[model samples]
Target chain A: PAPDSAAQGLALARNGQLTKPPGALGRLEDLAIWLAGWQGREKPQASAPQVVIFAANHGIAARGVSAFPPQVTAQMVANFRHGGAAINQLSRTFGASLGVHALDLDQPTADFTQGPAMTEAEVVSALATGWNAVDPEADLLVTGEMGIGNTTSAAAIAAALLGGNAQDWVGRGTGVDDHGLARKAETVRAGLVAHADALHDPLEVLRRLGGREIAAMTGAIARARMERVAVVLDGFICCAAALVLQRLHEGALDHCIAGHVSAEAGHGRLLAALGKDPLLALGLRLGEGSGAALALGVVQGAIACHSGMATFAEAGVSGA
Target chain B: PAPDSAAQGLALARNGQLTKPPGALGRLEDLAIWLAGWQGREKPQASAPQVVIFAANHGIAARGVSAFPPQVTAQMVANFRHGGAAINQLSRTFGASLGVHALDLDQPTADFTQGPAMTEAEVVSALATGWNAVDPEADLLVTGEMGIGNTTSAAAIAAALLGGNAQDWVGRGTGVDDHGLARKAETVRAGLVAHADALHDPLEVLRRLGGREIAAMTGAIARARMERVAVVLDGFICCAAALVLQRLHEGALDHCIAGHVSAEAGHGRLLAALGKDPLLALGLRLGEGSGAALALGVVQGAIACHSGMATFAEAGVSGA
Candidate 1:
């Protein structure tokens, strides 16, 4: 479904009469109008916002690309279940409903350097997990991921779709040292070379060079668009997943806003390619939907001001 | 009272052992530790945050330095009183206590282009209004302003304290035109020249070239510091107020963090001078503490993550 132009028009009209100078609210004004258009309401609200976290083990972890071992993915999933991760805290802070899904944690995706990271059937299952995870009642959605060696996969996907070398897209994930960073870049290069033929199709890129968690994010975002849930995309790996959808369909991410550009090396370039100006930029590099979860507060604030503020006539304030 | 070094040390130690990589949260980590230091708790929270808005009328508006008429200041104060303003909505969104102090809005200050903006006694009254408005129970504080043509006064104060010409500080405030901007620069230059001898003293400069609202912000910030409440200073006008305190006493703003750098031309330079790094930079120029109120969400999220996340040992997650 397309955005409601009528609702957007009304929102713009209301924004002008809110008593402050025109455009004084800056990007917040845009955020409110965008939400209004997507929610198809002149006064849209994300009263039931949702955040989903996908966890999967990556076979690429064997290549020494990440600082932490892959087993930490499962451990952190348990932490999330215990309400003990950063995302869990953030979800509570912003009143977001939290869900975590682990896709075959015991069966790691195949290393992309050797072949496709996942078979077609396996990729389909991962996509279904994400698609099924979104709540119909949710007015806003945020997706995050947990996989130690996923940065290598994300870098591969970005480079494959966006015409960048391994160096341009690679960065230290999970605090990898300089030597480990070189190893990650080399792994990205190998993965891209191994799947050069399959890379033309975006879904193939997801299966060949992306992890289950990444694939899940891609599917969840698509589901949000279908559900008319305005989405706030997370940091680097999350944006890489979104880029896959972007290449696959025009306006696939029209419902989405980049929550924040991560400190990751490729994120700024990726956001530029996607033409997204992020909401927050505190140099955060942590994933698990933390950035987007944090950004939910900003969106809610924008919506509240748009919906709850008084017009010049209502307040009896003189306007320009 | 000084920040508790012991609390900050404990916070730093706790941050090191959190589930994510070291410093993955970037400036948020600094925010949390800073909060802990001021709140004197290893796991501090801003459960009772307060936002104070100081509204006043500036005589400088008569010079055509602002796009809006002088009456807009009093009208906006009424708008705030009726809860129709942006700050009201933001306070409700973030669970902050909102206080609006219109410091004699019917009494426009003397135009600094010809003479001092306020008498010493008048400045003291405004400061006391701000100082008394702060809730002692507030764990976090944000101060903002509303005054047509206050930007001219703010620019004049920044120029006086930080050594810059009018051109370096002047910008389009409330959608000023090219001619209005030129007029603003001229007003600031005239104000600076009119009070050149008293410019060496920060408080004297505040009385001579600053508004009651600006003085009130300076008082509120000082009050927050005395109460050991962490402060998030707002845009150019707010920063200029904090700068008076910064110049009057060394490390006066150590308890403060810049909320956001406004789109105003002098704000980035002001932040640079204060040696403060802003939390958000969304190009927001709204002065009703909107930027600081929005940033309260960011600060709250950072504290939630810092205080609530399990340590690696507790989560049983492997660490680097």
Candidate 2:
């Protein structure tokens, strides 16, 4: 949905009269006006935020492209279930409901370097799974992912979609050593070469080089826009999914907010391509929706200031 | 008191056992370690946060340096009390206790361009008042300020302490016009010249040019460190206060975190001089503690990740 320009104008006018100097709130005022436009209300309400963590295992893990073993994906999922992961704690802190979904828990994708990561049918199924994960009742939706060697898949997809070199796209996933980074880069380069012809199609790119979690996140973002729910994109992998979604569906990112700039090498470039500014930059690289959850507070702050703060007239104060 | 190096080491060792890759959490892990050292606990808690907003009127308002009038200071203070200000909403969202203190409500300082801003006795009284504002039981302390034309005062003080020219230090406060900005710069330059001889002394510099809120914030930061409470310094004016506190008492910044790099011109230099990395960089220039209140969430997220996350052994996951 397009943002309501009328409401945005009203919000901007109100901001100017809010007893502070013009633009004193800086980017915060901009965020509030953006939220007002999306919510289609002069005073938008940010409540009942929900975060979903899509967990999957990547076939690229077998290529020694990640520092942690592929089995850690399931282990971290269990950790999330037991409320022992960073995302779990963050969700609790932000008062958001946490959902952990193993989109391909029992079925890992084929190694992208060897062939396609997932079949077209599997990609469609994963997208459906992600689409179904969006809750109708939630006002805000945040997307996070848990997958080992997924960064390698994300790099290939990003390289194909954003027209970047594999080496430039690749980063040390899970803090890999030099050898592991080299292997990861080589694997991503090989996958891009294998899928070069089909890379023009967003779904083909996902099927050929992206993991189930990325596909699911893409679906989640698309569905969030359809449902008029605000989306918060997490980090590098998540932004890669958003890139694919934005390519497939124009204006998909209108409902989305980039949560943070991840420590990953290509995350900043990905955010720039997507045309979104992150709210926080604490050098966070954790990808279990932790950054998204942390950003909920900032989003809420923007909403609170936009809707709840008194205007100059209401406060009987002079304007700038 | 110095940070507990033993606790920091223990926290670092524990971070290695977390289920994620080593350093995957990035600066969040570092923030947790810093909190551990300050809290003197391997698992530092970020509960019971408090934000104190020091409200006063700056003498430099007479120079027409600010976009907003001096009367807006007391009006915004009323807004804070009525829960209508940005800081109030942020405090409510973050669940931090809000303290609004009118340090010199009945006593506006003199124009520093012509003469000293405050008397030695008034500065001493303001410092003690700020000292008394600290809550003994609070775990985290955030300092914010509200004073019209305070930015000009902050610029003068920063130029004097950090040894920079007024052109490098001056910024448009509350979205000033180009003419107002030029006037502000000229006023700051004149004040710096007037107080050049006494600028070597930190307290004398504060007395000659700094607003009461700055003095109070300096005192609050010192007192918070003495009470072993972590301080989150908001924006440029607050950073100026921190500069004075650091100069007056060495190691005062050990308990402080730069909340965000303000849009003010000299804030980056100020943070660099203090050797602090801000948690957020949202281009916030709103005073009255809004940035610091937003940062409480980030600080809490770090603490939550540190203490609540499951170790590799505990989660039955293999290490990288």
Candidate 3:
């Protein structure tokens, strides 16, 4: 079931009686009410949060579409294991268990400019890999990704799914120079042109233009909804995967929260399409689930304020 | 001294080698550099954070200037004492020591519409009280306030300091109805008009048209700068206090960060006057340092990413 409106109302009423003015907590109050509704209780607790980083290599790197080489993808996975990556430090700081899934780092996707990024069967397998990675015991889940040149694939997928020019969606992934950025934009354009027939079907779009990590993230989001776990989405790549999931399941975004707005070009349009407002907008463009991991503390803080705060009646404080 | 430009440049250079693209971390990188410069160290740590909630009563409440009665101010102070207020909960969540100081809760300031909010001597004493509240051992300080109808006082002070009409500065504080908002606006206009002779001097403006808590907050900001402590400023009321400090001392904002943009009407103009970009934009209007406390984690995350995470060269990962 969706969040319970009755619990939300009760929480809202309780907030009015708290020591502060009505709606003074602003989005924190709304967050508390939403958590109450989602938890089906007057007070919700965001305990045992988990973060998963889906990583894979993109074949578009062969075309010099990204500033960083594809080998960095495998290297970053090792960094995650060694607790040296930004996501690792963030997960530890925010008290979330970090899970790094290197889904096909050894097998780069086919260059989508000329052909489908992955076979249909590979996409399904990747989705299942993401779906099965969810921990039912987690109170909250955050989705993140790490793949060199995956931004090109994400941009291609976004352009096809969102119906805009490739130039509008393409950005300087990994601080690519002007030439590399132009090449990436052209690569997305060519991929979209090649997959025009498949663009209408979300699944076909994922197989043709999206990388395995994105497909996996979509599956992860779907599974999180099915398991009734709240998901905090990272930046553009994760949001692109969410777009695919939202298209397939109309209410898929009901369980998700945008953690931060990415510095990518099309992210604003993508977020608008999903009707989601991000909590933080610090211009984060890192893709290793860093943005989402940074948001875990905020979600926890919101839940703590909801579950642990004292009401006016309880605190012997006068109401407004 | 101001933030060390050399340290900031060094940190910026270091960020480029941290596996992600240059400027990929966005505001987080900037935060790291800012902290580095402020602390005069290449790596900074937000180790000990302190939050002070200055509570007082507003005489303007008798004129129907607020939704809540004046007694709620004293009642909320008791709530803070018992660790039941939102600021208390946020303080605990962010690992900050919470201090609630009721400078003169039983004695409401004189209604500014009729006369000065406080005698000049009382303003100086309150400023000293706020100045002495700073913990020199603390790494971060957060300022918050609790006073009914204080928004009216804040709006009036902002109108005088920033050169605006009362209607532009007035907002529906504490969920005031349209009639109450209109009354509050009128009250500010009256107060500003009454204090027109003192409007040119920032301290005179605070004394004539601002509440005791606002005066104390101004002192706190000034003291934080002197103590070299980083301050996370709360919503509109706190920003109003900061404007006074900034006018009195040009570098008062050097140690401050706007925690969030309040829902108040004139807060945008106030923040613009100070040239501040708030970290959180959840429309929080709660005054008791709740927004600043909530921002502690984000600032910490930025610092951690700067100090703890590995560089691409160290991790054998290719840089953008």
Candidate 4:
């Protein structure tokens, strides 16, 4: 669904009436306008933001592609639930609600290097899990992931969808050394070769090469568009999930904004591919919605200024 | 005085024990460490941040350099006092204390193109006003300005210190047209020529070519270092203020970080000369402490994560 054009038009006019120069706020002016359009209100608000975390185990962990074992996925989920993780601290700092959903952490997806990562039914179920996780009442949404070896899956998906080589999409995940990075790249290459036929269809590509958490992020983002909740996409794996949706539907990610470009090398490339102008670039790489939650402050600040500031006439200030 | 290196070392050790992988948080990790050092605590806090706005009139407005008239500076300061400006909204959003100071708004500085912008006594008083504006109880600080035609003054100062031509440092401030831009460049050149003899000393350069608000920002930043409060520098004029201190004393801006790289053309060049990596780059050009106030969220988030997250052993999460 397209955003309300009337609200956007009204916001544009209001931006010009503010005390500063026409575009003095720069991207923040655009952010307020974008929020107004999505929320269907000339005055947008960012009071209620939601952050959801999807956790799953990828079978690719057996390939020694990740520094930590797959069980760490379940462990981190426990940490998130107990409010002991970085995302939890960020959520608390921003007053954002944090939701953690673990998708069959004990049952890992099939290794994509050997065969399809998930059957069509399995992929559909994971997508539904993600879609159902979104809160319709949330004015803003951010989706994050927790899956060991998932970077390898995201790399394979990018290689399939964006036509990049495995090395181009792969980066060190969870502090992997040089040899591990090389091995991860090779693993992605093998997965791409195995899933070559399914690359024709974006959903099929997701089913064959995407992990459950990544697919869940895809579903959640798609659901955000339906619910009229603006989304802030986080890091590399989240962008890979958005890629599947961007390829699946024309203008699918229009309601979404790149929260921040991470330190992961592939993230910049993925942001470029997604046609997203990222909001923040603090060299952050932590995935569990930390970057997006941090950016919630910026999004909130933009809306606050848009709604809270007085126009030139109201302030009795002269304009150019 | 330098930051507490002992606290920084302890904070570094604590960072490695957090649940996430080593350096997974990227620049945020460094921010946390920096905060810890400045605050002299292993567990840094961002509970209170102060934003100070200095307003003045520049005589160069008579040269038709800015889009708005000179009177608009006083008008905007009144708006700020009434809590009707963008900075007011941002301050409310981040819970920062805002102090507005109008430095002799009725008296515009002398035109620098003909002679020094301010007498030595006037410049010293302006700096002292900035120095006295800071709140010692605040944990973080941001300095902003409201002065029409001040960008022209900042450009002349940048060209003087950084060895650039007037055209290289001049930009379309407050949305000037091409003709106004050319006029601004010529005005900056004239100011530089008029003040050539006094450019040998940093304070003399500030007195001869800098506006009151710009000098105020310089004094405020230096006061922040003395108080051991971490500073986040704003846009082009603010950087030009910082440059004076950076050249006057070695490592003068060691306690400061560039808040955001603004859309003003000279801001990026000024940031590069200072060797300070900016936190946000949303192309913001509004100079009313808006960029640095927006960045307060990121700094708060970094410290929150650093102090709030549980250690790997405490969370029972697997480590690499």
* lDDT, residue A67, model 4: 91
- Model 4 residue B283 CA deviation in Å: 1.1
TM-score of each: 0.98, 0.97, 0.97, 0.98
lDDT by residue for model 1 over B68-120, one digit each (tens)?
A: 88998988898888888999999998999998888998899998989999999
Ten contiguous residues minimizing lDDT sum, candidate 1 chain A: A311-320
On TM-score, the stronger of 1 and 3 is 1
Q: What is every candidate's alpha-carbon RMSD to the true fold?
A: 1.1, 1.5, 1.7, 1.1
How would the docking of model 3 be graded? Answer: medium
Per-candidate chain B TM: 0.98, 0.97, 0.97, 0.99
Model 3 spans > 4 angstroms off: A4-13
In candidate 2, residue A115 scores what lDDT? 86
Error of 2 at A21 (Å): 1.5
Off by over 4 Å in 2: none
lDDT of each: 0.91, 0.86, 0.85, 0.92
Tens-digit per-residue lDDT, B217-275, candidate 4: 99999999999999988899889999999999989998999888999998998999999
Q: lDDT of model 1 at residue A243?
A: 98
How many Å off is the CA of B298 in candidate 3? 1.5
- lDDT leaderboard ranking: 4, 1, 2, 3
Off by over 4 Å in 4: none
Per-chain TM-score (chain B), model 4: 0.99
TM-score of chain B of 2: 0.97
Listed models, DockQ each? 0.83, 0.75, 0.73, 0.84
What lDDT tens digits, residue by residue, belong to model 4 across residues A1-320? 89999999999999889988889999999999999999999999998899999999988899999999888999999999999999999998888999999998989999888888898889999999999999999989999999999888888888899997899999987778999999999999898888777887899888889889999999999999998999999999999999999998879999999999988879999989899988988878789988888899999999989999999999999999
Interface RMSD of each: 1.0, 1.3, 1.2, 0.8
Q: Distance from true position, residue A255, model 3, in Å?
A: 0.8
